[model samples]
Target: MSETQNFIILGGSGAGLGVAHSFLKHIEPELRKLGKKYHLYIIDSSSHFFWNTGSPRSVVSAALLPAEKLFAPIADGFKSYDSSLYTVIHGTAVSWDVGGRTVTVELANDQNTQTTLPYYALVLATGTRTPSPATSLHGDHTITKAAIEDLNKKFASAVSVIVSGGGPTGVEVAGEAGHFLNGSAGWFSSRPSNPKAKVTLVTNRDKLLPVLSKPRALTAEIYLNQVGVDVVYNVSVVSSTTDADGKTTVHLSNGEQWTADVYIPAWGITPNSSYAPADLKNDQGYIKTNHATLRAEAAGPRVYVAGDVGDYSRGGFHNLYATIPVIVANIKRDLLEAATSSDGSDSQPNEPDRLFTPNNSETQAVPIGPRGVGAVNGWGLPSFLIWLVKGRDYMIRNVSATVNGNMV
Candidate 1:
């Protein structure tokens, strides 16, 4: 096989795994039949992978699979392959050179030794970074052990807690905090208490779960209220300060202030594009891609993008269900030298052509305490069942199984 067909994948999170799985499921068979040899290199900084969506539950129940359980050793998972066919490196990519087709990665322990891995094709699946205050205020920011420890300490002493932001992450944190304070009747004999630890969920939006429909939003509000969370709507925080007494004073834009023992900032996320190749990125620092094809719009053939870093009109929630299939098909076609055309297209397309088109099936599900509100394909389903399926279990088992290659 030519060196140009070899693949180097950056970021081994959901997106990275998705692309790798796609290649294995769709493209591997064709390559094996043709007796073609292709190298696949997977790189990530961390050895552990946590199910981020399940983090709220981790904070509340303190029940989480160990870091090793949540992730498969990258080397072990690919050990069967020849060294030339597949390799997994534990390092952080400092930057990429588009013109040279090289990626510079710094080893975890040996920061001084930087290695450049030249690739025929590159997949930029490095997801977004968590927001500033959230990432800065706490260590192990990516919903890992260290982050849960920080929250646990606050929960132990907090009399009142303030959760800023009304988005899915904020809502989940607020609801989970309430559950931690109130305790579970079925699971525990006594409820946990910080006595003064009241949870106040502050949202600038007029309603909770603004992305969901009115009915679902109302359902989430009801659930939160029932769990003893103080819902403050249409209020924005102007400034926050820590008093001499070690309490946090949050000044609201609506001319109100509240004191809390702990405050959690669950604001939105921004893409982490600083380490990526500049030429492959758009003005927003997100990778510019043919939404249909999932290939870099500027880079030539073989390179592809998936998950959060890729600019897709369908938004975050839908990208999981939509982009994976297209990426798989494209990779397979590229391996077989098949025509790079859509299913019904008459002519093969050039590099950087749109391979997939998105539909307006974007949906979001927010878990409020033990109940949840969801919009399926823009259709509202205000039910407590959504929470039962997602909120209660946090999908930890499913994620663990996937990382273990069980296909659960």
Candidate 2:
């Protein structure tokens, strides 16, 4: 074994960068103490780490959170670290082979470079990709930014807006639209004094926030009702057409047609797992990950999975924190074992200290307008608390720390 090693983190969004930050911030010093070195590479489709948690709010009004705040340069975030320590690849992984310990990346520019990178360890954090309007998990973020701007413009002119998909994103977007456009976020707005935004959230489920309990879901629906946002249940957006006038006619499953100024669909997700090994994924295309180790064992050694792309647990905000630490610990443990060994081979530890056992309990927060609903470990939290936790700011303030590796 050489004195140096290479680590590749695919998907520079939340989970990908989080692993990079965690590994570097926590492991670099330990490696240095042993005179060992490693180079980290972060690859992603976007050059920026979008603070997507604030998307619902950013979509409503850019003044609240400017693009500068929403999109942080991924390269600059790691500038403080040594120049040779890591490289940020602004590209997408087109294919990877765990058996060969190599991944192929297609560059994101006109030159169209395809590079095959070898790594001592590989972390798959590509996450899921939703359609155009729902940009949170979209791979091409520049397109997402532009699409969102167009959406905001359409939303500004359209008094009647349709938010298709009753999931967290759809409901939250509807909430933000209703909260701000109708009343300027209860603060200030350059929008017309009385924008009177008519926002409707459509879902195939019977109630809003299907993740929440029936009673908790009722609270969300009640809040939307109080804010004048209509909730259409058990209905799906079958198809949509936009005319030259920018008016969208949405066709529903029930043969109902509605014309709205804006149509935003937050449903339908395609896991960005195409580049991953076939054996790593489940029937749904999400990577099948070990809950205890966060590794796709079929991918062979030092290959782990994290965040929404993995099927170990439901992808949630806190789940990233829960899962990445286990991955980092396992990585760190392996690195430490090799560093301390007489020969460069892993000295496996017996303890399960690095494992994380996923459970059926829920920990999620969905804010609607100003009020919200949340639960942690099956216990419901108060609406105001949920609002305080996310609605007030959408955790925009934490994006920098998250990108820079402080909050993993």
Pairs with steric clashes in candidate 1: 159-196, 159-197, 160-197, 292-355, 292-356, 293-355, 293-356
lDDT of 2 by residue, 208-324 (tens): 776778888887777776566888899999999999999999999999999988788888677888887677788889888787888887887778888888887676777777787
| Tens digits of per-residue lDDT for model 1, 1-408 | 422355788877666776775666557656766656567888777655445676555554344323322334555545444556667777788888887878898886688989898876678877776552223212122435665565666666676989888878888888777766764323332233332357889988888766677777776766666566777888887888987766789899889898887777666566656777677677778888887778884776677887787766334445565676677777666656532334622234355433666655537877777667787788775557676667656666666444434441
Which residue runs of candidate 1 sit more than 4 Å off their true CA positions? 1-5, 61-76, 79-84, 132-143, 183-196, 238-257, 277-279, 313-318, 338-354, 405-408
Q: For model 2, which pairs clash?
A: 180-185
What would the TM-scores of all predictions be?
0.83, 0.92
Error of 2 at 353 (Å): 5.3
lDDT for every model?
A: 0.66, 0.80
Error of 1 at 164 (Å): 1.3
lDDT of 2 at 130: 69
